[model samples]
Every structure is written in C-alpha cells, then in structure tokens.
Target chain A: MVESRRRSGRLASVPTSRNVKVSAGLVALFVVVVAAVAILVGGGDDGSDAPSERASSTTTTATSETSADAATLPPVVTDDPRLLGAPGSSGVTFTEFLDFECEGCRAAYPAVEELRKAYAGRVTFNIRYFPLPGHQNSRPAAIAVEAASQQGKLEEMYRRMFETQAEWGEKRESQAGTFRGFAEDLGLDMKRYDAAVADPATLRRVESDFAAGSALGVQGTPTFFVNERRIDPRSVDDLRNEIDAAIAGS
Target chain B: MTAAPAGTSSDAGVRRLGLVLLLAGILGLAASAELAIEKFRLLEDPLYVPPCTLGGAVDCGSVMTSDQASAFGFPNPFLGLAGFAGVLVAGLAVASGARPGRWFWLVVQAGMAFAVVFVHWLIFQGLYRVGALCPFCIAVWVATIPAFWYVTLHNLQDVAARPSRLGAVARIARENHGIVLTVWLLLVAALLVERFWAPWDSVFA
Candidate 1:
C-alpha cells in the first residue's frame, strides 16, 4: 500500500501534461478537507449562557426599529429586585443592560452618560447586569458595583469601571486586588467592599439582573430599550434621533 | 512525457488553476454552513454568546442577531455557502478538464462581486448598527477575501488585469501578479480601516 501511494505521489510530480489536472484535483480535495475540518472544529462551543459570548462577532445587524405603539405593551415591572431603573413614569425611560468587563459596554458608558445629562428629567435611566460568561472579571465587577451602591457610590463605581475597563480586561496581575484598588479610588470602605463582593445576596442581585435581561429578550450586553421600545442605533446620530423621537413622542 | 502544443499547455495551466480555486470554494462552503448552524443555535437560546463575544463593544450574538445577518432572509453566511458551491462546481468542472466556456467564469466573477458588496454591508452593520465585532464571522470574511480574489484572478487569465476590472468584469480574466497584489492590498486596507479608523470615528462622533 505504501509503495502504491508513493507511486501515485511520484506521478504527481511528473512532467506529463495530464498531471496538471490531477495535481489540481488533489489540491482541491485537500482544501475541501481542510475547510471541512476548520468549520467543524473551529465552530466549537457557542458558550451563550446568560450572556452570549459567541466568538464570531461580524454579523448582519437585525433591524431594531420599533413602532411608536410599543407603549401599549405590558408595563415594565420596575419593582422587581432585578429592575435597576425606576418604573411607572410616563416620560422616556432608558434601561441599559451592561457587563462591567465588556469593552463595548465601557464605550457606551460615556455615550449613555451624555444621554443622561442631555435628557436629565426627560429620560429616567436604569442599569441592569448581563455579565457575559467569557468575561472572568465581569461577575466580580458587578459585585463591586453593587457594593458601591450600598455605600451611595454606585454612579462613581459605574464611571470608574468604564474608565478602567481596558486595564482589567487585559490580564491584570491580580483581579481581586485590582478591584479593591478601584474601591479605594471610589472612597468606599475597603473591608465592606470586599465583604459585599463575597456576599451571596449581592451576587444574587447580579444574577437576577441577568435573568431579567433574558426575560426581557435582552440577548447581549450594552443593549438598551428607550421607553420600553427597542431602538438600534447605528451611530451617535442614530441614537440621538431615537432618543429625540421618544422624547418627542411623550 | 512529450510537451503539448502551447495552446494545450496554457489550457492545462488554466485547468490546474481552476482546481485550486475549487478547493478554496469548498472551504468557503464549509465555513458558511458552520456559521449558519451556530447562528441558528443562538436564535434558540438567545443567551448563548459564542467565545467570539468579547464584551459590550464586540458581541457575537449581538451582531449575529442583527437584521444585517440575513439580508436575503436566510443567514448571509449560507448565501456564501451557495455562492461558494457555484464557484466550486465550476472550478472542479474546469479542473476535470472541461473548458466550461467564458460565460461560466463570468457568472462566477459576478457572484463574487456581489459577495464583496455583501461583506462590506455586514462590516458596516457591525461598526455602525451593532457596534460590536463577531470574531468567527470575521474569520469567514477573511476567508472570503482570498476566495473572491483567487476566483477573480483565475478567471482573468492574466493577474495584471485586476485594477482594470475589464477581464473578469466581461468575459475573460487577465492573470498577473499585479492584479493579485491589488486585491490582496485592498483586502488588507479594508481590514485595517475597519479595525483602527472605523471604531475611533464611531466613538468620537
């Protein structure tokens, strides 16, 4: 068998004109096999969980334009421990689901803050957690944020987390230690911050936020619902337009 | 081992090149199929973000679920599979020693042109609409860039004809190193712009 295979291999290198076709065929077959293997193995596990972490990020965007009639949909129950935004108001309520470890979420932080400042009383903002599983520091980051909430420093923790997302995203020499440093920067009690992180209730709150996001059909982090209406903004202008429309609708 | 006539020798070369392109097409087909399956799985669970999900800035599930994922009602990746299949069949036929005429190659080149535009659309959607990146989808895009270029190169007998867009755009494809380099450079430029410049503009704006 080995000799026969070797003979065929030798034939491939021959100057015979027909070998061109044969060689191409063989190469084509090799490419097909390689591609098949790549698709099969490289496809791998999706690892979606509460937060989707699909490795393939380039995809066609689904249309997120919402009809003005979403107001008729069932009112959002803000009293749920998971609901971070205050509910029952008639004006535009912007609820954003975020993951602290997510870079996109961090990028949107300033934009969201700007929207908040611009809309102030016109738009009531609420934040929910949708920690992606791939982010090792995300759950801890959420816990730290909640701990800061306990100390009336939730907004500071939120801003600080976004500002320093890149630092923690890279392999921080020590995660817990690094988060503690954040706590110090935010002027929270170091011991209490540590305790809150370890606290099961705080963790539960974060987990509950994930559940709420899922229940609301929030598939990924940094998703926002303006006035309970799903709005997909392709640019800052697009987001501004959506907010403007929602505000005008009220 | 006698040498054939010049016409026959060149034809043989064409056949060999066709086979190489067929192999690329098959790989593209397989890649597209896998992407489609993964996208379907995400539809079912909604929360199942693949490893490609980096964060809020770049999420695989977010990009996949966007309207841009299915410009043709089906997952665009599957369209890639069909397109690649057409390319593979034509290439394999040519490699099998069938000429398949200029029309066949023309059609294949046209399909690839549409594919180039489609991929650009997806990139724009990711950068603008979703504001995230899907890593595997990007792999598909990378693989496609080569496949499209090679197919175009093969059809244009001389690689030098790429910048002209006359050969492949019409009936014959010119084959030369210049065309190959141009396509390669264009792909690289697109990726660089998307990676560096696009995001900065989006954020700052």
Candidate 2:
C-alpha cells in the first residue's frame, strides 16, 4: 500500500522538462503533417480566393460575347423553356441548372419563384434539366416537366413538381405514374401527354441539358448563372444581390 | 514528497477531469437533444427544412435523412443522450470527491473509446457519403473528442507506471497529451477541408 501510494505521488509530478521537449517535437511534427495535407489536398492551389478570381475572369470574358469568347462561354440558354421574361430581352439573363428531385432545388423554389415575380421583366429566367444520377426519380421528373412544356404548361408543372417534391422525391421506384397524374391534373390531352412523356426525344432533351450542365462545370443542382457567370449564392439575398448587380451592369 | 500534498494534487486532477466531463456532457447533451428534435420534426414533415440547413455543403436535412444517420436502426442521437447522461452522473460523482474503483475507470475508458470511434465514423459518413455537415452534429463531435482524449489520458497515467511496452507508450502519450489531442483535432479539420474544398473555395472565391 505504501509503495503504491509513492508511485501515485510520482505519477502526479513526472518532471516537466522531458514533457516540454516532447511537446515541442510533437508540435513540429504536426506542422509537417499540416503542410503535407495542405499540399496533397490543395493540389498547388494557393487559397480559396483562386476560384473567385477564375470566376471573375470568366465573367469578364463572357460579357464581351466576342466570337473568340463564344467557344469558352457555356450555352446558358438553348431552346430551354423560359420561366420568366422573353428571348432577346434587353434585361439580364439568368439561367439555373436544376434537378426536380434535389432538396436544395426544392428548398430554393420559393425564393426563385419570388425572384421571378419581383424581377419579372428585368431578368430572363430559364431552367435547364440536370437530373443527378443519385436521385432515382430526377430523370423521370425532368422528362415529365419536358412533356408538360410541350403543352405550354411548363411553368405550372414546374411549380407543381417543387410543391409535391416531398411526396415523390428520393423514392427508389420510378415516379412516372405520379408525374402522369400531375399531367392529368393540368388538364392536358392524355394521348399527347403520354406520347410526349414516352418520346425518346424528350429523354434526349433532358440528357442534352445534363450534358450542357456538365460541360459548364455544374456539379450540383440549382447552380445559377447570371449573364453567363456561375454564381454560388448561399441565400435568396445573395441571389437577389447578384441579379441586382447584373441589372446595374447591363 | 508528503502523501498529503501528493493526494491533494491527485484530487485536484480528478476534480479538473470531472469539470471537463461535466462541461462536455452538458454541451453534447444539448446538441444531441436538438438533433433528435430536428430529426423527429423531419420525420413528421418531409418538407420541413431544418434551421441549420444552410443549403449546399452545410445542409443538416440531407445528413439527417441519410441511411448512416440511423446506423443502429435508430437515430444516433439516442446513444448520445444516454451516454452523455451517464457522463454527467459520473462527473458529478467524481467532482464530489467520490474516488471510483478501477472497474469504474475501465468502464469510462471503454465507453470513451467507443464514442471516439463512433464519432469518427460519423464524421467520415458526413464528409464523404452524406456530403453535408450538421452544425449540431459538429458540436457533438467537438465535445466528444476532447472528453475521449482526456479520459483516455487519465487512464493512461495509471498504466504509465509499469515497465512494459504498453506502459512506455502510455507514458509518452500521457506526457504529450495536449499535443496529441491538438494533432488529432487538426487532422479531422484537415479531412473536412479536403472533402469540402470545392464549396469552400467557391464561397471565398
């Protein structure tokens, strides 16, 4: 018992000098580890500011729209149904690459709708189909919207898709019937709607949009572009600010 | 070398550990409870957006609804609730000068080890599989990590007295506890940065 007590006492005060030296060495080791991780992860990229700099450079080049720059700029609008404004509008053009089944897109739907209403005449809002492979129902949902667009009910079906996303999104099974139900509710000709929904061209159109989105560096849904400059807006306010700036610049 | 002063310092160390445990337990409990409530709300209403859903990389809704969130066929927060409650009680007992037996310390050590591993697994799932971060979950992570480290170190100090290989390692670890903990946390942070580099880069860009 006495020996144990003495050992406990020694354990409590195990001389600080060795500890200090070891701690210093460990800290130095930590610095090396951090440096290695930074190098590996960053892949020679200097800082977070580099992406913004690249974005700004693209923005400047896109604004000019010279024939030389056309190849570099993404095809922001290509026969895609316009949600607001019109073709050849003097106002700022806003395009969103989105997936119907994406939660973020659904979450942003209300804000995007409000923006469409607020900047109705000033911004030409267009949405391109970009159904991510992860979301099982995204492709079918996009095709449904494309079918609705055939009957001039694109906006109505688009709104309905977001409104009822909770019911059909993320399901492993195809929600084609549910989308057909939506088309029926929209009072479309059943024969025409069925043909359009089943048409290989409609599926092709969705795939083309996905391809375009991929080419434009869109990795996720609800990726917005204001006058051909991709903007990562954190909130509705950020999106609004981008639009306002675009309007001012135009 | 008087036993009285030696005992006092040892008591003070236990008291300090108890204090850390208390703080971590409270913080972790709060974070876990909040997550449980949010998860319940999400189940009740699929469209219900969590307040912590910052969109993009920081969405709690995506993380909560993920398969990994229910690793044990139940929400992981339930584990936190029970474990943190036990930690709270242990803290109270230790803080009030209750010198627990070896078995008690061993139990605590085992629980902490489980918690540390589970927390790191969840971190991996969040960063890679789920591709989103929950603020409350992050809080729980922050709280659990240090608690695990300190508890393990306290136990190590006991093993460190022996003249064996494990004892040598324990002594080294106990001696450089702060460095080890800091490095552990920094590595986790580095992983987080690496996983979400694109979003972070764009945000600052």
Q: Highest lDDT: give the candidate number.
A: 2
Q: For residues A1-250, what per-residue lDDT tens digits would candidate 2 score against the true structure?
A: 2442454544433433344455567767867875676557645564432111111101101111133345775577765454643543546788888788877677667777788888876688898988876668989999999999888888889999999998997688889999999999999888999999889999999988877777777766668888778897644677788888988788
Cα lDDT for residue A196, candidate 2: 94
TM-score of 2: 0.58
**lDDT per residue (tens digit) for residues A92-198 in model 1:** 67777788876557556677777776766666777877776656787888888888888878778878888887778634344767778888987788888888888
Kindly give the stretch of ten consecutive residues in candidate 1 chain A with the minimal lDDT sum: A54-63
Regions of model 2 farther than 4 Å from truth: A1-74, A84-90, B1-20, B23-93, B96-129, B132-139, B145-205
Note the Cα lDDT for every prediction shown.
Answer: 0.60, 0.72
Per-model TM-score of chain B: 0.69, 0.91
| CAPRI tier for the interface of model 2 | incorrect
Model 1, position B70, has a per-residue lDDT of 82
Q: Candidate 1: list runs displaced more than 4 Å.
A: A1-20, A27-77, A80-90, A170-174, B1-205
- The local lDDT score (0 to 100) that residue B145 gets in candidate 2 is 90
